[model samples]
Target: MNPYSVRTLWISDLHLGNKDCKAGFLLDFLNKHDAETIILVGDIVDFYSMKSSHHWPESHSQVLSLLMQRAHNGTRLIYIPGNHDAVIRQYLKFNFGHVEVRASHIHETLTGKKIIAVHGDEFDSAVCHKRLTAIAGDVGYDLLLFLNRWWSRARQRMGFPYWSLASYIKSKVASANVAIQRFENAAIQYARRKGAHAIVCGHIHHPDMKVLGDELYLNDGDWIENCTALLEQHDGTIQLIRWTERCELLAESYAFASLQPDAVSEKKDEAA
Candidate 1:
């Protein structure tokens, strides 16, 4: 297949310095796709996990290198720091080579639709007000991801196609679904207040696209559980892409609302 050329590409929650990051799959995606503007919607690196144990592999380094290459190649690069990499927030309004750092950005799509692009953590009430509750949730989520990793490997060995055990289980979780709904509503409300037609974010690691009246809510998903990204076609039509294997691409335009949420915390919302 020919390379994927898009108007905008948004991906997030890579958790690069953590073991659960699927750097290999992302590497392939990066190699295959190129956009006029590449938006790193946040949590591109897992600073919180690295604080306790750093796990930077070569593939992770390559991913960063490739991004820099894109920047130097004249692609508009924007980085919005999520809670995991919130320290980078101090550098907002600063430029790192060809990339610009911002807390949130007002973006106009090819079709002239205004969008409030942010990391979406600020709108999550649980992450902001309940510190202990957030941490406990993280612990539970970590255990789930651990089991998911092994389950995926076993499936791979048995010649089954790639499936997200974590995402599947999260679909059955009521509390997680509630949290996700709250975040989505809050984000949509904020966008409406800002007079934007849509909101794009990636803190919950849930890949989604929902049309509410005249507004839209989009999440690019994450590299870990879903291995998905938000892709804007040349005509400005947006879609969620599932990048499982290197050459396989699954475009689920709207059937992903069920696979919602990963983890959220005051400081440690890894995509895993």
Candidate 2:
């Protein structure tokens, strides 16, 4: 990637097989922005459940083509498989157009900032600990996606913006919060130990950018909730962006490898 004119974008948890994947919005975004590099942090596909019985959608295929087009047009793309699509990691050496697959990687920004990028499933003890909970979660998430799709579509007819009902409910569940917190803590600690200034990941479906001591932690969030992403610019600046009724900026801060709280503040005050 060209450091002088290129920007690096990271996104994850797209869950392509789910009806609520929001491929239209994502495709629109890609068509509008010409990034120099794009990183799919993880779970770009919900293969775990997708392989069972659900049929694929045309919108999903369009989104994939859009991405491939960008790669063909000189935009560098990298994909890291998440828990939902962990099997893809087996083909780490493969490349599709300009897109490459990697189990995990270290990204060094133009400004000399170093960060590790991963899908974040390894940090989730429940996902790694047991087979049953993981299966249950996948099934539940799929059902929620089904309802979210039809419900949000109906909402659109009623003049409402798209939103994930499943995500909203998950936020209110205490068990989910506990699980998220545990995962976040693990990622932060791992970054600090690896001597990285920050760690970037996707999973947990929450968008956040935090500075913890000398290390930083960033979760791109997911299409299911915030529909957000993280961008690293050549000037060493890092930004967290959210896509809603349209594209929006959520937060921006310096590129520090350590997870530092308060390093980046949500610019909700600037929302129009």
Candidate 3:
């Protein structure tokens, strides 16, 4: 069975040392997909949470090992440290074999659009206006994620498909929605300042992609609650795929193989 081959794969908010990290799902995704380049947008390690409640299982370790092995095997890996693991910022420009650590990276899609890869905390800090306030907000966000886990489990037992309780709550809350909007706006502004046509980031754990005026915004989401990844096809099309929802439909190794260009466009041409 062929694998889902992609030109670039972006993933972030792994929070490897945290209990909520979905290492198993990430492993499954990595096993099923092949990418020429992998961008670890940020929070790959939850050093912040580790200080308070350490929880690193074998699965998490396996994920790290596999990524390093893949790097050694010639896959290009770029890591951008986020606030949670900002200690790596000191190592910016360093290379551990095929892996490169940088403050940020500008990725040029096959279609020639330049997109900056970042952790998105800069936008958060700018929008939140204060470090203390951002920390307080994080505490509340964690509570929502805790509740989201239990709610998801209960729903699955009752035969419901996967859903994000945290996302639902965020959408319902006025403040949360405002913060998200501000964050996205800030991201676009930053991209414009950097001369990029698009931005790919992950911090809010909200997987989304949209064209905002002349700019494109893409978030790879998180491994914890959403289990989503952003993919760039060989033809330069971007896809935001939530693995949890499609795992059943993609049990076959050849599922989504090649992720080719638009079939709808081909159909239209044929019709004409």
Candidate 4:
């Protein structure tokens, strides 16, 4: 399959430096797509995990290298650091390599619609105000990811395709679903306040595209779990693309060899 050329691409929750990061899948996605603008929505690096134990693998390095290469090749790179990598917030509005680092950005689409791009953590009640609760939630999420890794590994051994155990569990949990809804509503409100036609953000790791009345709310999802991204087409339409599913399709067609390894073993040691 030919690489998809898009107007803009937004991805986040990479959690690089964390063991659970799906760097290989991200690299594969980057290789298969070219965009005029690429937005690193948030949590590009898991500095929280790195502070305790550094787990920067070769794949993570490759992901960074590929992103820099894309910027050098003239793609506009915008990074909005999230809670996990909040240290970068100190250098807001600065340029690292060819990428622009900002707390938030306003993107004007091809259709002349203004969309606010942010990490969205600022709108999350637990993340913004309840520090203790946020920490506890983080711990719980890490445990979920650990179990998800083991489950996915077992599925692979049984010749089953990749599945997101964490994502499925999140859907089943009432509280988690409510949190997602609140987050989306908060994003929509923020967009309205900003006078934007829509908002694109990542932090909750839930990939969704929805129309709330006359406004739109878009979440790029996360690389660590769902392996999804939000892409803006040339005509300004936005859609979520699941990288794992795309890789699986490519593997089935025997079109790309790079995604083959990931399609078989996407699980990583828990430390997310």
* lDDT by residue (tens digit), candidate 2, 111-200: 567788888877756334343243225667667667777888899999988777877777777666666666677888888777776798
lDDT of 1 by residue, 158-262 (tens): 998678888888878776777777777888888898999888999887888777656788888888888988877676666666776533334334322222322
Identify the runs in model 1 with alpha carbons over 4 angstroms from their true place. Answer: 126-137, 246-272
Q: Model 3 compared with the native: what TM-score?
A: 0.86
Q: Candidate 4, residues 1-272: lDDT per residue as tens digits?
A: 56678889899999999888888778878888889999999999989889899788899989999999999999999999999999999999899889999989998887677889999878767334343233224777888889888998899899887788988877777666667777777888889988988898888888887677567778888877889887776766565667763442111111111212222233321211
Each candidate structure's count of clashing pairs: 0, 14, 0, 0
Whole-model Cα lDDT per candidate?
A: 0.78, 0.73, 0.78, 0.77
Provide the RMSD of all predictions against the true structure, rounded to 1 decimal: 7.3, 4.1, 6.2, 8.3
What is the model-wide C-alpha lDDT for candidate 4?
0.77
Worst 10 residues of 2 by lDDT: 127-136
Model 1's TM-score against the true structure: 0.87
Candidate 4 ranges with C-alpha deviation above 4 Å? 126-137, 245-272
- What candidate 3 gets wrong by more than 4 Å, as runs, is 129-137, 158-160, 245-272
Tens digits of per-residue lDDT for model 3, 95-141: 97778999999998886778899999888667775532332236777
The weakest ten consecutive residues by lDDT in model 3 span 263-272
Better of 2 and 3 by TM-score: 3
Q: Which ten residues in a row have the lowest lDDT in candidate 1?
A: 263-272
